[model samples]
Each structure stands twice: as C-alpha cells, then as structure tokens.
Target: MIPFPESTLLVPRTLFGRGKITALPALGREFGPRGLLVYGASFRRSVAYGRLHDAARGLVEWAEWEHPGGEPTLDQADALRAAAQTARAGWIAAIGGGSVLDLGKTAAGLFHETAPTAAFHAGQTPRHAGIPFLAAPTTAGTGAEATPNAVLTDSNTALKKSIRDDRFMARAVILDGGLLSGSPAHVIAHAGMDAFTQALEAFISVKSNATSDALALTALGLIAAALPPVFAHADAPEADALMAGSHLAGIALAQARLGVIHGLAHPLGAFYHLPHGLVCALCLPAAIALNRTAMGDKYMRLSETVGGDFATVTNTLLATLQIQNPFKGQPLLRKNEILDQTLSSGSTMANPKRITPADVEFLLSRLFV
Candidate 1:
C-alpha cells in the first residue's frame, strides 16, 4: 500500500446547490454588516444578480463594483482594494466568473496592506490579515473560489501571476448551479475543458499526494461525463456535477500543483489575450504527448477512470466542442519571450517530467496548424 504524503489542504466552508445563493446574506453577516460585492459586468443583468441583491437587502450593507472584462490585472486588483477600503468593508463577496472572483480575492487579501498589488506579485508578504471573503462562482471553470490563490496579470509586462496565501481562501463559498444556465455554449465548452485539464495535470503531477489523487480522479470522471451534455444543451441535469468537478479540480491543483499545460497556458493567455480555458484546450494534447512517457501508469489509470483511452477521449471532446487551436498558423509575436516566461512558471517546475528547451520547441511546433 502507498503511504499517504504530508499535505496541508485548505478549503472554505461550502454551500452548494441550485439555491445556495440565498444563504449568502447570512454568511455575510458572519464577518460584519458592510462588505464589497465584486461581480462581472454582465452579471448586472442576470437573474442571479437579482437573487443575490434580494438576499442582501436589509441584511447586509454592501457596495457593488463590476469587473471590467478580461483577466484580473494588478491595476484592477488595486482599484478593487481602493473601493473596499473606501467602503470600509468588513468582508468581500465575489459573485461571477473566475475573473470577478479573483479580483475579489485579491482585493480582500490586500485590504489592510498599503503596498501595491504588484508588490505581492513580486514576492512581498502581506503584514495584515484580510477581511473575510465569500465567493459565488457563476462559471464552473477556474475553481477560483476553492483556491487560496488569485491570478492577476501585470498589464505592463503582460505576464500573468498569482497572489497566493492561505488567508486568501474564501471564508464561505456558494456554488449555485442555476447560475450556469446563462453561460454561453462556448463558455461552457472552454471552461469545462479547463477544468478537465486541471484535473488531468494534477493527477499526473510529481507533487500529487493521495488526497490530491483521489480528488483528481473523482473530478476527472465527473468532468468527462458531464462536459459534453452540458455543452450541447445548457441547463442540463449534469450541470451540478460539472460545478462540483471543477471545484474538486481546483482543490486538487491547489495542493498537487499543475503541469506543463498550465505553465504554457499562462504565457499564451497573457501574451495573446486568449481565453485561459481555450489556451489549456489547445495545449492539452501536446502536453499529454510530452508527459506520456513519464506518466504512463498514471495515464493508464486515468484512462480507466474515464472509461476509455485518455488521448482519444480528450481529442473527441475537443472536437465535439469545436475547440481548435487558434494559434495555428499564427506566428508567436515573441517566441523566445514566451519560452522564458513558460519555463519560469511555478507550474513548469511542478511538471511530472523534466521539460527541456528542445522539448518546448517540439511542443510549440505541434501547436502550429
């Protein structure tokens, strides 16, 4: 029998279901009356927002800030911090997609610190504990709510990085599957693919422990079974499975770390302005092929877990979702720059297999149409 590895697992107190959003007001009161609500711009018109607003009425004093689209950036995080400070928020409630959640996490984590968000990105430790944070994720992807890290991009360098701390973990998380009904088909497809990639990579990561492995396997199975149906028809019964799977994948990666797929996805998304999930979808095949030799046993187990050959299953799913490599035939603006950035990523360091420069070149070659 394999021995359990030493690990530190952190997760929020979670309430998951179709109507879990209603519990937010009571959860918010745990921290204090005043809080900041960070959400996606599109969510302003969503029914989910109406439900949340109703729940907050007379229960909590909150200020709303809509996240301008795209990935969270340092400037955006700083702006959010400023808003929370101005509101004298005792907690932060993030309600939307990954970007909105990440912004909320960052703002809350940095609430008491006067240093710029970039300082934390540069490895500066925060001196004060942040306000309580609550997350209600609309999208099943990124698992940002379950994670203790918030990804933010440095606009000047166009490099994506993370502000990670155990304190950044949400105090409470509400995963309401009903919110997913409004997501576009493409959003579901890409986000589901990202969730799958996270599970797969964590399962095969060198750092994976027994806890991570178990969660990754369960997440992979759910994602494999749920993604297609959910993508084909929104509001599928399997939507909850996808949400749970995505959250589990996030938890798995938070402990086990990720691999080459995420390492490459970050640089690609940062430089090309590609959707993160799409980047993962595009890179999955090459990453799997590259890591196959090192992770043969894990791959076989994964294949068994998902009920088919891993490569064939993933390729078919990508095809069914109409997810193609957009980078194909598009010359990388700065090939060497991307290479350096990818190699320097924490995910790359955690990859199960050692990746050399030549291997990176070969992988990039395969991505071309």
Candidate 2:
C-alpha cells in the first residue's frame, strides 16, 4: 500500500459531538462581522436552519442558495462567488449535506478563480486568496468537512470534478446530530452507504497506509452498528456511534483516496441528477466484488467486518442498499445495456482487483439480473 503522507493535515480545528451544534452561535460570533451562508433547498427547510440563522443573526450576512443540487458545477461556483463578492461577505459558512458543503467549499475557492471550477480541478492556481470556510454537516456521511477536496459538476462537459488541496478544508467544522433529525429514510440509507464505501475503499485502496487503515477500521465498525437505527430514525442520536466513524472515515480518505464506487458514481450523478446515495448504493456491491477478485484476502477481511462470507455479506449489503440496476426501468436498454452502464464507472480503476472492461460487464450482469 502507498504510505499516507506523514504531514497530511487532518480535520482542521473541529467541534464534533452530539448537541454541540449550539456552538454555531459562538463560532459565528468569532468568524463573523460579515459572512456568506450557502445551503441546499432541503437543508433550508430543516429546522436546524432556523437555529443556525438565529445563531448567526447580526453577526453574519447570509447569502442563501436554496438549490445546491449535489456538487457545485463551474457555473454554480461563479454565480456563488459573484454573489458573495457583491454581498462583500467576509467568511463563508456552509450548512447542509455533502452536496451543500461541497458547493460552498468549491464556491469559496472559485470565488477567486481565473479559469473555472473545472480548471481548479485540473490544476489551476489561485489569483486571489480564498475566503475562510466553516462547514456544519447535517448527514453523517462524506466527511467533506475533513477533506480538502470539493466535488463540482461541469455540466457543459457532462463531468463531475473535484477541487482539492489544503486550502479548501474548513477552518472549523461543527458536527451536530440535531441537524440530522428530519433526514428521510432513503437519505439515511444513501448517506450511510456513502460512509461505508468511504471507509471500505480507503482501507483497501493503493493509497492506504497504517494511519488510514486504523481510521478506516474504526469507522467501519461504527457504520455497521450506528447506520441501521439512524436509517429507521433519522433524528436518533447515535452520537458516539456516528461521530467517530464519520470523522475517522473523513480523515482516512483525506489522506488516502476513495475507489471506483465514488469514481463511477460521479458520472451517473452528473449525467442523471440522481441522488448520490442511491447511485452509490447501486455501485457498492459491484465495486466490492471486483475489488475482492483483484485483491484476494482483503475480501475476507471485509467479509469479517460485515459479519459473513464474501458472497453472503455482499448480497446482504446490496439488499440492504436496495440497489437499482440502471437498466431496471429504462425503456431504451436491454439487460445487457443496464450492465454496460453500471460496469463503465471510472472508479473501477481504484478497485483492488485488476478489473477489465469485460470483468466489469460480467460483474454488472450478475448484479442486474
């Protein structure tokens, strides 16, 4: 495995706990005087919004984006930055799910961009210093707060891209479970699946090392136990269960990268505007199977983590995720067509196994049928 960078920074200063979200008022006070608030439509409705707004009152100038659908594409980033500049907001506080946080993160970076959010992803330099960012996570997935990377969409090119590096990492992160209260069952399932894949992929990726493995293992265990009840009760305070896991997974992937599941899922999300969790759910099983074929005993270790043999546990996971074959309802595709789409993810390269295009076809065929 590739060694984790010894000097890689983890979660910048953080306030992670059950109800500690109340500290948002205090955090807003410190970073305040004037600031930009970026959030998603769904999150804007969540009661936590009122609380955050209340806390930030008078201290910050809020710039609300009710529609932060998944990643913020280059266009979205420009609009956000232009708006922020117009507002003259000093700090940026992003409150919502992975998509919202990602959009805010990218916008904060692209606010000073010369090329585009896509160019930033493709190694562009910043002409202006970035604004300070703060992220408050609503779901227990994607650990975007801990990651320096911000995923964006380039709708023009039909691609989902990433804006990365140390600068984008939040100066402070608040993980309060209260924000998770109204998350729907499907979202719970999707976010949990994302967290699961994050930890698992980081553990098995070529970029993994001892630090990442320890963190991944710690995250995998919490995700196994904490996710189900949270799915059933989106508001349930599986506090200790989730905090450690999500952050651990976040930090793990911060150093190591995620595999094919994420790589493949991005295109589907960019192309179809699908919920990230749903696509991730569908891809997880296939990614795992291919990884198993390539890496060997790692599959056994994964099986043990989930509590069964590779095949049995794998099937159970897919069932739990309610994975839908892309071809299932499409009128244009035959069974082979569905398999072809699902099998074509770029993330396939990150699989532990040396999966070929043909191998993906075989694996996806079994999944759909």
lDDT of each candidate versus the true structure: 0.88, 0.71
Tell me the deviation in Å of residue 181 in model 1.
1.2
Number of backbone-clashing residue pairs for each candidate, in the order shown: 0, 2
lDDT of 2 at 319: 71
lDDT of 1: 0.88
Of the candidates shown, which would achieve the greatest lDDT relative to the real structure?
A: 1
| RMSD (CA, angstroms), candidate 2 | 3.3
lDDT of 1 by residue, 3-99 (tens): 3546565654899898888888889998998888888866788877788778888888898899989988999999999999999999999988899
TM-score of each: 0.97, 0.87
Regions of model 2 farther than 4 Å from truth? 1-4, 57-61, 68-71, 321-326, 329-349, 366-369
